[model samples]
Target: MPERQDPFATLFDMQAEAMREMFGRFAGTVNDPAEADLGQWTEAAEQLRTMWLDFVQERMAGGGDPANPLDPAHWMQMAQGWARSAPFDPAAAQRMMADGMELWQNLAGAMLNTGGESAGEDDREKPALPRQDRRFSDPAWREHPAYLLLHQTYLMLADHFTRAAKEIDGVPEEQKGQLTLATQAMLDAMSPDNFIATNPAVLKRTVETSGQNLVKGMQHLIADLQRGQLTHTDAEAFTLGENLAATPGKVVHETPLYQLIQYNPATPDVLAVPLVIFPPWINRFYILDLTPAKSFIKWAVDQGLSVFVVSWKSADASTKDVVWDDYIRAQIDAIDHVRARLDVPAVHSIGYCVAGTTLAATLAILARRGEADKVASATFFTAQVDFEKAGELRSFIDGTQLEMIGKLSPDGYLDGRYMAATFNALRGKDLIWNYVVNNYLLGEDYPAFDLLHWNGDVTNLPAKWHGDYLRDLYRDNKLVVPDALEADGTPIDLARIETPAFVQAGRDDHIAPAESVWRTTRHFRGDTTFVLAGSGHIAGVVNPPAANKYQYWTGDSAAPSLEAFVEGAREHPGSWWPHWFEWLQQRDDARVPAKGKRKPGGRGDKVIEDAPGRYVKMR
Candidate 1:
């Protein structure tokens, strides 16, 4: 074929020239060694050779071909193939990267000090080690003179190959028959006047003129490497099932009691007030019961308090009829059952996330009928009682979207995947783009972090409950105002709740923003303490004593207003775990042994084995 004056080819040639110039500049900056120091140079050269050989062999065997520039489609196909074949080998990748980083550090140190003649002999013999290899491998390392020319040459050819492959892939199957005719017609259609008139052609011309292929390539590669390293690192650093494993704590009468409970010594003997933990039904309760160091449950149990945690049941199609009211009823039933067995007059209740909202509603319903004696105190964690400022999720609950989802299920529940996708879209840079680049392009595995794994373990919401929740709370912000929401035909009034209250809000929470949690303080008429924790929703509530990096701000204002606490909070940097422990201790009533003779056949018969509660382990 005759030589084609391809614009893309010309651009590629220019990029090659620029790359050579940049490499030469970097090489010139390196200090030159004396002839007598050839031995040291030889050793460094041999190390470099070994590294390069290993990289080449690895790439040839399975990794991306260094001789091939990455085409999006080819890269995706190759990555998917690799993932299917080998999955994510996090351990192996971590080890390889670690070794590579050490080698690179040693090589750089040798060059930088040049035997440390300017410093003492001790310094020359033992150099301070580099920082732990936090960053991924820099592609720029290949710019050394020895590999520069060959690497560039390989990349150029690969680019051409990738471009050709992409063109072939983009062609419609039906149009393949008239390829030559279409090409000539395209040439006829692309006359300079037509190109100037046509927006598509004009846009094409602008891209060609920018001459940004190499910059784009480098950007793409950097993104790929970063994603790969993160995936590999996360996978190696975390384990989904393993991290969620329950650690054994003190057992009360053959039942596992989380270690966070405490009881006050100065209270009536008849009142056996236990802390009722209402963890979100979306995941297991063990996020609060993680490990002794991070375990809120464990900490509480150790405080000499009686603790009762709700173990949620998993739902299948059989449980489709279960509604929001059913959950509230179940919780109240648990309370009655616990009271009957323990002969407790009242219990302090702590609710987290969605469960917090449910418990708040339950309290309101009970209070409206003057039945407030059932509960002693109420606490919420990153929970929203006022949905007026429901944060980013507000945009998603428009009439049209609600109606569309309502049509899918007559009752109004949206699919769990839909919710997951929406949450994922919110942080597309970190969730979507990062995963795409890592798993699809870099052939890396997903991490096994406990929280992230829990996040991935999605559960379906009942259509009716979801629809009612979004429309009433999010769309209209009805929950906070008077007579806004009705439970089983009874209106919910927050002013009726007279129990002592504790509310915790995280500063960086995007899910239930701090403002939403803070608003709950306005409704409570009794003693209240508002705490500002120093992490996101999950991390803040799951704040174990071991996570000492956290800080908290608490205010003296028992004011009936959220704004008053905002003014009172002075910034204090340290773990909030100790403060919460102390605060809960003050509120806890004195514990009493089970008043009546122990009932032989109580709720314990139905209790499942001590694993993560069913809802959490489902996925």
Candidate 2:
């Protein structure tokens, strides 16, 4: 029997066959076959064959090295050897291919005399077509075909090496029983079950935290396949609970809030005390009201504060024209409507992430018109009023890139898909490469988790709003500086507002750097309290009662700024939820009868629902 060919070798053969077919098609396009230059055609064909043969030989030689086959110890040696012998070196293969293709086209044009005479003047005067845009254009590899070839080749070699390393490390070696036991102990500690029970949210986060590694491994085996899979899986897996509890025993609101209007007879009564929630459009609002034990909303309600959350609807193409002004106006209107219905005093507002910017804009707009009395207090959660030190993501959103993105979504709407991809890319080694190995190569099914599902539940931004935000906040650092922005031609100044304030910062947050959050404290003139919490962006904010493992530090003095507080404050080992609730309660007004008590309109009787709200349910 003939020797079985390697799967990759078969791919190479297919590529060669496709190239031959392309050549045949090019040859057939000649109008006058009799006038063709056989000499040039023959020479070009021979060169193509030689190039392919060299590529095959190099592949065989690299794989045949028995000493280094799938060995991590030999990674450096294998990389060096492969790099030295790369057959597809930049200048060698690409230049030759370009030159040969040009020569071949010229010969065809010469043979096809049908339009040559008529087009001679036009051809001479026409500027050379701009070089076709290439996929990879790093100048370092401009003249290095071998570098490109080896870059691709090493990906495959690396995957094999990684898998082999894992296998070797997992097995017991001679006279190493203790080492094996220690390794097993570590693996047990990191096992998904332990993480799942201790941190239910870890199921989804493990995938995100490890997504980069998965993508890298998958990219070598299947281009763009891993991204597609992740996108689909994430989009599909997102789910929000269908029930809500306004009070412990009075009423159990079990309707999908997204589909219902705020039409409680008590709407007028509850509206008296405005509860403004700033929910980032990036995900659903339930992160705050996650569960009864950990639900910020429940805690607020229990404290006799009338609470209202900004329930952001799923954005699609129709939301393209909704700019920053529209969102600010909607929020302001919602507050005003509540005020009208309740016949009560000004509202207290809480803003988070992107919502913080929106709230800042609203406050500025209100302050410009001398409507500051409407807002009683403002709380910011990992929100940055100043974007100058906005974290690692700042490096990516300079003017040029933002402009390009603006053009793509001119209405200022940012595509959620693009945003997801960018965040994934930032930590490609873990988020991407790991999944490629487990999901695609190893064919593992995605594990389940609510928080990850929420993280993946992305929403789009209006092109106009996205552009304005990037320009004003990120690129211009407008919100942090007085007179840095204007809404509807009215200037915004954060310092002029006298609303009491509370701000929280996460030490490990990559989205909003702690410094930026600290700088925002300077922008507030009200009685301000800033706290530092342990955890990343999402975890720090969504921390539930179950997460007793984490700790938060608090202080009374606003001197030395946020950075000083972070450095000096002692860790009070416990969930930060209780502390935050206490701070908020101090600012909350004492309970009176809801100004205009509204009767419930036929929902469920009093009952406790599962954690996560209706908006978070998977579609």
Candidate 3:
């Protein structure tokens, strides 16, 4: 009854108890039904505030006034120091330390055993060691125990954070995803590579530059702040109509939704069926016609195919009422215009990214309404009709995030810049930090890259259309389900689509996962050929044969489970363009020699403007 607790133990217990109480209060606020309007961010903000205050108090014992301690930059610096204050869970850290010790012991034993021994046959034949992670590749860091310790500690913490986030109980899926993302982002930001203290390369650079890199980095940061966005590439280096979207074409037709550009025939003989393209409106249409070397439009035109491209108008407050049906109607109108202009029985159709989903829906509706004959065949590039495996981007489209986005778009149109920023975050290391370091840290100019330039040229999404897309396709997943989606007063059934299909999936695509794109084959009853390209979404589609780069995989002339397909497939070097062109030719009617007398616009009355039209050039 009179047993007294040790004062040191009692003090530590009291401190731990205080922390638990604080966390309990924060968790209660999160779980409270009354705070539902605030969503999961309330707790995140509260935790961040607590962390910030603790960090400031700990660091500024003899400090001057902490001006704007809540500043994001200050918070970032504080977060980087969090590991020094016990960032990892105690249990997880103990386990990691034990494993690390065992590894160290094995390494010491190996070093002890290797003493002037001649290489044996088995040693010589040994397979090369697995490639090291880029962050740990530098040999200079291996010479120092402190550097090694920092690297190992950060990696161990990263692993534990990922595992802990997945094991978190009673968290909403979206919240869990956000937590995992945040954890990884923190670990990446705090990585040894980012600092001079832990990174030998950075230390050497600092020594050589006499700390000028820091000054240059500061100047770069100031410039970026003034610009209000991160610049990844030099946009001034590339002009839309001159160097990019340079494929020669004229706008033959225009609608509220899009401008139709029929390109000049490069080959004397053109296919009887014209190819009508539906490009995703989220970005500018120039991705398909980025450059002479990678331009799909140029390749198609050069292959004796008459080509027409749909360049969607960037949405504005005036076009806020535009919806899914409006896009479908515009597509139908474009196809009709192409058929009328070229005087063909049917037109070949191709869709890229979001356009592919819309095109599939349009074709399905057309099939239902007995208008399927308008499209001769269909090809999709890096598109998915099914959204089940839509990858990491899906997490940002949940109810909470969607609502937040809607609130931000007061003018009834989602800002294109915001969309671009989100995409940049998906691969922040390559798309963001590297640029940050190059432009700011190293005081270097952004390079002139066609792809990066195209990436920066984004377009707005009409509020109604964007909302419908997120709710219908992503949230409700109604596209694949029969009668769940209707356009032009007709219900759609993908099984009714009789158009021969060519579906291309990128093996490394994180946006539309390969399996997600491969599933489209089952929806079409007509012949389908699915090819798995060997890169991410953009590079895979823009692959040129001359590059002699990334290989593609093809199997038993049919679509199957992605795993089975890849397993049974044989790898082929170079691009998939030639294979796709051959497939198109097989189904196309006889080619006819081009008549120079007939320009791009068949009847001049329907012509609106030139290629790379007003819509594309619009801000």
lDDT of 1 by residue, 473-590 (tens): 7778777787776776678888888887888999888888988888888777777788888888888777766656778888865655556776777877666767765676676645
Order the numbered candidates by TM-score, best leading: 3, 1, 2
- By the TM-score metric, which is better: model 1 or model 3? 3
Deviation (Å) of 588 in candidate 3: 1.7
Candidate 3 runs further than 4 Å off: 1-94, 100-131, 136-144, 163-178, 196-200, 557-560, 596-598, 601-606
> Each model's C-alpha lDDT?
0.54, 0.53, 0.73
| Cα deviation of 112, candidate 2, in Å | 65
Model 3 TM: 0.79
In order of lDDT, best first, we have 3, 1, 2
Give the local distance difference test score of model 2.
Answer: 0.53
What is the C-alpha lDDT profile of model 2 across 77-108, one tens digit per residue?
A: 32233223222234344544555445334432
Tens digit of per-residue lDDT, candidate 3, span 98-158: 7656544443223223421232432454322122456666654443333434455456657
Task: Give the RMSD in angstroms, all C-alphas superposed, for model 2.
Answer: 22.1
> Can you tell me which runs of candidate 1 are displaced by over 4 Å?
1-245, 248-271, 407-414, 558-564, 592-608, 613-615
User: Highest lDDT: which candidate?
Assistant: 3
Q: Report clash pairs, candidate 3.
A: 268-594
